[model samples]
Target: MTKISTFQVEDANTQIVDWLKIYAENAKVNGFVIGISGGVDSAVTSTLCAQTGLQVLCVEMPIHQAESHVTRGREHIDQLKIRYTNVNSIQADLTSVFDTFKSVVPHTSDILKVNLALANTRARLRMTTLYYFAGIQGLLVAGTGNKVEDFGVGFYTKYGDGGVDVSPIADLMKSEVFLLGKYLKVPESILTAAPTDGLFGDDRTDEDQLGASYDELEWAMLQDESKKSVEDFSGREKIVFEIYKRLNFVNRHKMIAIPVCKIKK
Candidate 1:
């Protein structure tokens, strides 16, 4: 049997710090802008960016439905002493976007259309706020996606969370991300809590949507080189195959260079 423990966690602290410094110096940025969602990914990214000595402006944009969790997110961010802004993009800009889209996308269940549209609006508005701050403050938008989400499953929205100038941990897997978070001494409450994007109802979370535990997912993804091939498909292999196919299709656009037409001259 292939071992999941073979997935080693290396320290990217020095590299991340140097990268942020070079990016700031090259772009002449005064700081960085990040979205804090009370999740490990953003929290860890914000911390690393802050450690680089760049002024980190963290925005907590929450819907009325997710305010409590956002409140917790805010408290967690405060513990890190990162400069922060609480922008309620959901109830205002997000709601408006949903209403506009629903009027044209064919009448459907308000719950389904409203929820999906609202999620998209939330992502777009958050990016708008990030860029707005970046413009005013001369900051770069730092992305928080880990390797698993960025590569393994295309778990982000285009022009949404995917719209970042730099990704600090894009090469690290989910397990590696937790290791780095622990290495950075991030707070226990934020580190140990369930992973989520806070895009749904109060108790909603990412694992529930994926229909598998993070551990189970990671186990399936940690395929050994020797174990390659459909022959290796065994327990949980079906789950891995389904996930790989779905995310692979969903994120195909993210993996490509922008299409350009070439004319025969």
Candidate 2:
């Protein structure tokens, strides 16, 4: 575990912004498109893209189950004053999409799959919407996954929230993202809000799903750099550890591009 220069907060922020600028220039993207989940990761990503002088198109696609996050999503966009569009993909659309799959195969006790499918559908739909506007507007799809989630546990859905042309904060750890948020001067309330997927019913958080809090995860990831031993193994910690071990396959199969097999003579 290599440690990024903790001394270079300003440098890191500048480098991130500059990298985004280069991508924007090379890709001929006049703006950036992001699915704003009102979560810290998306909030930080969207705000950074907006502040970098790109036309940030923030999309809020709240399912019927997550109608409550709608207001919070809108509030963040409103506060940012970036060009935002709210698109709702509620039960009607989700049910419509899943109808075909369910008809092909019988539903099972895998309620997790059912819930994840609904959630992932919303995310992918938002990505599709972003690309729709991006193509029309000559913009790039900016991904919002951070380092901790990207490396540790593969916490995102494949072809869902995982699609993007460029990720502005993929290198920043969870704690570093918070620091960047402060550097970007994101609103205090959003900065302090609990990180969540907003896919679950009610105000359930990502920490709730992962078992361990992001704060604890961040501490462990950072501290593990030295010859540090894990002191406690909570149920959540075990789950997260398993996810970390499994992320290689998750990313290789899901997030990565497919490899073509060639026949040799």
Q: Which candidate's TM-score is highest? A: 1
lDDT of 2 by residue, 134-252 (tens): 79778788899987777656677777778888988888888778877776666676677888876555677888777677665665556444444434445666555444444434555
> Which 10 consecutive positions of candidate 2 have the poorest summed lDDT?
84-93
lDDT of 1 by residue, 176-247 (tens): 677777777777877778887766555767787677666655655565223555456766787665676566
| Candidate 1 ranges beyond 4 A from true positions | 1-10, 65-68, 82-114, 224-227
What is the Å distance of residue 58 in model 2 from its true position?
1.2
* Pairs that clash in candidate 2: none
Global Cα lDDT for candidate 1 = 0.70
Q: What lDDT does each candidate get?
A: 0.70, 0.68
TM-score of 2: 0.78
lDDT of 2 at 160: 72
